[model samples]
Target: MDRQTLDMEGARRGEISSASLQMGEDTIAVQCIATMSVESMEFSPWETATNKRAQSLYASFFVINLFFGLMALAWGGLFPGNGSSFIALVIGGVLTLLGFVLGIRAAMMARRMKRRQPYYRLVIGASDGRRIPLVDNNRDVLMRIRDVVRHKMDSGDREIRGDFDLDLDLVNLNLPTEAQKAQTLSRGPDIVPKSRQRETEVEAATAETESEVLFDQDAEIIRDAS
Candidate 1:
């Protein structure tokens, strides 16, 4: 049997090598393989579809009711002082109110559907041959994940270990503060040249030495005059 083989003999004799353990450790590194953007429809396909259908029904009902209400009002105006005209006016008013209510309900439902839409998902590839999916509706979370993966890759660590939670609240805490971000941005090269800075320092030192020597000469002249 080959040393690389993890057969029953190796298990029975307890002869597992450190190399195998290292290989297992290597498999646990995390890598970002792919990403997917989850829209509202994709996040809850059935729910979104149902909501859309309901919205359409409600909108149609509103339009129909509005048409009937306008027609009834016109009819009532044409046949003034009749009992049927009074009834038509009342019925039209009720329908118009009902249509308004339905329209409002539909608008509310549409707003909710838009709010529940997911922003994106990350496909994390682990060294252990497992692909884990991390999803969130916040763009900030996606940006943080991208930064983490880029840092890991730049450091030559092709794999990431440990469990990475996809929760937005949890991941959001890891984001850099405004001050930290500002500091990072300020790390760019300054406008002044290094050579100019060195020259200024040298000139200042020479001026200070000359001032000191002049002071000593004045003290000597005072002693001679005394």
Candidate 2:
């Protein structure tokens, strides 16, 4: 019969849709949100790519080249008088440079992949018990939920309730996915082809010329009548 009961009924049917957080008379206290932070978690170097085998192969190349190059250099240093010492030095230097370049490439790729991933977390501390946690990948969705709960808290709502969906491990963070980027590009303003634009200009020019000729003919007939 009251507002609380109505909200509860709506929640039961999943009509109240937003992030996973639910706030109402039976939910956790919004004031319990003691800390809020945006964080990032890195994907493992091996697990960061669609092509796992390629990633593994590159890593192997880095290790193998570096190891062999160092060994060859050591051999050259220990046997300077040997006939092959100069050859060993040359091969070692080239291989070492190649290995170093590969290692740098791997490091840069890892950093880039990490930048594409992000996490949004909310921590709530209960006055009477353990802390509660809510995590989501969508920054906008999470912020909206937080604002709603905070509004209720600021308005002196003591009987606050909060619900969270803890199964968020499979959810990915908000980023411009390749598909989304392509979709956005597709929505850009339509551009007229150059040929079509040229045709329109020519039609306007012809219309203007015809109008000028008609005006000249009317003037000549008026003069002859005078």
- Best-performing candidate as measured by lDDT: 2
Off by over 4 Å in 1: 1-47, 111-120, 125-132, 137-161, 168-226
| Poorest stretch of ten by lDDT in candidate 2 | 1-10
Give per-residue CA lDDT, model 1, range 24-84, as digits (tens).
1233232333333322223432244567888889889989998898889888989988889
How does each model score on TM-score? 0.42, 0.33
Cα RMSD (angstroms) for every candidate in the order listed: 20.1, 24.2
Q: Model 1: which residue pairs collide? A: 27-127, 27-128, 29-159, 29-160, 30-159, 30-160
